[model samples]
Target: MAFSVDSTLKELLADERAREVLRKHLGDRSNDPRINMVLYLSLRTIASFPEAGISQEKLKAIDEDLRKL
Candidate 1:
């Protein structure tokens, strides 16, 4: 599957490369228990939440990495 910012968290997490990209950008937060609650949400949706701590720059970096996979 082609992964992008619009990809759901579950879809990204299902791919090891995508998971690594998320880990690189989000650190421990990528594995947080709360992540389960948003698995069905798109990266774009989650990034929109200020509490998610994902700045637009970070999201861009993540999108770039995901594209490489």
Candidate 2:
């Protein structure tokens, strides 16, 4: 089963430390959907371990995107 952004954010909110960290970055923003999207994409990119034929250039692009978030 896929772990979605809503589910993940729900889980994160349940943890004091996780919630604190998130609040630090997001402040009191009412934009849960956008925040959830950023968190979800960051987690997905970090979880990826691509195989051969996918060049280093592609990997760097992923890294840059994550850093921007």
Candidate 3:
């Protein structure tokens, strides 16, 4: 029952607001697979918590990679 990224994340991919935000940062790179993967994992991490001030070191790392892409 793993939420496999390829098939289970369709709702995240289909969300207009999510796409809009990613597009703002990524431009053409928004559609890149690596960029999407980081975003997907970041979203999963965020959803794991219910409070504010969550440390996002991993997301920061992902963003650094995103910048390289």
lDDT per residue (tens digit) for residues 1-69 in model 3: 222212223444565554444354434354555545444454545434544222455445434443333
Candidate 3 has an lDDT of 0.41
Cα error, residue 43 of model 1, in Å, equals: 0.7
Which segments of candidate 3 are over 4 A away from where they belong? 1-11, 30-40, 43-69
lDDT of each: 0.90, 0.43, 0.41
The candidate scoring highest on lDDT is 1
RMSD of 1: 1.2
- Candidate 3 TM-score to native: 0.31
What global local distance difference test value does model 1 have? 0.90
lDDT tens digits, residues 4-51, model 1?
999999998888888889889988576477988999999999999999
**In candidate 2, how many Å is residue 65 off?**
17
TM-score of 2: 0.34
**Better model by TM-score, 2 or 3?**
2
Q: Ranking by lDDT, best first?
A: 1, 2, 3
> Of the candidates shown, which would achieve the greatest TM-score relative to the real structure?
1
